[model samples]
Target: MLSPSPNSIKKAFSRVALVGKYQADGMQEHLGDLAKLLGQQGCEIFIEASTAAHLSLTAYPTKKIETFAGAIDLAVVLGGDGTMLGIGRQLAGSQVPLVGINMGRLGYMTDIPIQSVQTILPQIIAGEYEADTRTLLAAVVLRNGEEINRSLALNDVVVNRSGISGMVGLAVKVNGSFMYNLRSDGLIISTPTGSTAYALSAGGPILHPRVAGILLAPIAPHSLSNRPIVLPQDIMVSIEVVDGREIIVNFDMQSQTHLQTGDTIQVRQSEKTITLLHPRAHSDYKTLREKLHWNEYPSTF
Candidate 1:
C-alpha cells in the first residue's frame, strides 16, 4: 500500500477538471452528477472540451488539456485505466492530483467505481484521502543518430514487430553496459505503476506502485534463458533493433511510431511523477486480490 505524504494531505482542490471517455455509456449522467456534487461543495469545475461536446454539457466551462496546467487544481478522470494513462502522461510533471472512476474492465488505476462515486467523492473533496506518486518513463526514438520522436508513458513503452510475424532482434543496454541481445516477438519496458499492465501479461512480476524500479520483459522470447529483469530506477536503457527487422515503438499503448532497422529507442526514468489520490480505505493488496481474483476462497486447515 502507498502512504500519503504529509504535504499531500488536506490539499485544497477548489478547482477541478473532469475528463471522461467520449460517448461512453452513462458517461453523460455520471459526469453531470459529479460536476453538480463538486459544485455544491463550493468547488469550481471544468469539463474537458471533448467530453463536454459529447455530453452536450454547457453548464460547466470547457477547456482543453493543454490549458489545464496552471489553472486546474485537480483532474477527475471518469473512464478506465486507459483514460487515466493518457491523461496521467500529460499531468505527470504538473503536480495536479488525479482521481479515477472506473468505467472500463480491469480498472487497476481507475479504482473508484461509478457506484461509489457519490459516497467517496465527498470525502475526497473534504481532503480525506491519500496521495501516492508513481513514476513515468521517457522514451526517445533515434534514427541515424538523430533524435526523431519523443514521448512519455505512465504505463509502459512497448517495442514490438511492426507487421512481420517473425521475431525481431533487440540489443539491450543499461547505462552503456551490455545486458543481452534478445530475439523475441517484442519487448516491454514498464514502470512499477505498469507492472500489472502489459508486463504482467508477458510474465513480468507484479511490483508495488511505490517500488522504485523499471521492468524489462521480453515478449515471446526465442530462448528459455531470456527472462524478465528488474533494474534500478536511475539507470538508462537502450534498445536497438537489429538489422533487417522492422519494429514499432508504442508509448502507454496510446501512441505509436515505426522504427527502422538501425533505429534506437532510449528509455529512462522521467523527471516527472504522477500523483494519484486514493480514498482513505484504499489498499494496494486488497485491490490486487480483488482485481486478479486471488485468494478468493477461505483455506481449510
Candidate 2:
C-alpha cells in the first residue's frame, strides 16, 4: 500500500459539503451515518439541497448546488462515478477538493469503498491523503460564425448519430490544419481523466493522468484503419459535420444538442481543474488492476 506523501496537507479540509446520488438505495441511512461521523470529527457538514429533497435530512443544514462555491472547502461525494462527475462539474472552477466513496460498479474516480469509509475517511480528514487535479474540456458549437451552445466536460465530448438511421460524416481539424474525414457511428474526444471510461470501450489507450494529451477515438468507423490517437493538450480540435442527418453532440453524455450539416464543434483544454483527494495509499495501476480484475487468471481448457 502506498503511504501518504510526507508533504500531504495538514488539516486543510474542515468545512465539507456532502453530495450524494439521491435515488440510490439506503441513501437516507448512509447520509445520516456519514453526517454524524463528520460532526463527531469536529467538521461542519452541509448537505446538497437536491439530496435533501429526496430524503428526510431536515436536522442538518442544507445548501444549494450553486451556493457551494466559496462556501465549502471540501465535498464528500457518495455514489458512483456518475455522482462524482456531476458534482465535479459544479465545483470545477471553485477548486474545492472532492473525495468519493464508491457505491456503484466500476468506480474509477470514486475509489474508496463504502465499507472502508469509516476507516479511511478519517485518515483523509486528518491530513493523510493524496490529491489529484484533473482538467476539463471546454467545447462550443458554432454555426455560420455564430456560437450556439457551450459546455464543459470532465470526461469527454462526443459527436454522434442521433438515431439508427445513418452514420455521421465528420471532418477533423487540429489547430486550423485539416486532419482527416470519416463516416462513423460517432467520435469521442476525451481528457486524460476520461480515457478509462467510454474511450476505453471504444479501443482508446489508457492515458496516465500525468500525461499532457487528449484522446480522440472513432466509434465503429466504416474504415477499420481509422484508429484512436492522442493529441497535444494545447491544440484545439475542430470537428465539422460533413454529412449525414440527425447528428448530435454531447458533453459527457449528460447534455446534448442536435447538429446541422454545416455546424462545427470546437473543443480545447480548459483552464479550470477539479481537485480529488484520495487515501494516501491510492495508486492508479493498483486501482486499474482491482477495478478491471486484471489479476484474475483464466481457467485452462
| Candidate 2 clashing pairs, residues 3+ apart or interchain | none
Stretches > 4 Å off in candidate 2: 1-10, 298-301
Error of 1 at 68 (Å): 1.5
Model 1 per-residue lDDT at 3: 69
Alpha carbon deviation, residue 36, candidate 2 (Å): 0.6
Model 2, residue 290: distance off in Å is: 1.8
Candidate 1 residue-pair clash tally: 0
Candidates in order have lDDT scores of 0.89, 0.89
**What is the Å distance of residue 236 in model 2 from its true position?**
0.4
Residue-level lDDT for 140 in candidate 2: 96
lDDT of candidate 2 over 1-301, digit per residue (tens): 9765433434567788898888899888888999877776677889989898788689889998788888888899999998888888888898689999987565889999888899888788888899998999999999998999999999999999976769989999999999999789999999999999889999999998888999999999999999999999999999999999999999988889899998999999998899999999789999898877886876652
**Model 1: how far is 57 from its true place, Å?**
1.8
Which lDDT tens digits does candidate 1 get at residues 198-237? Answer: 9999999999998999999999899978999999999999
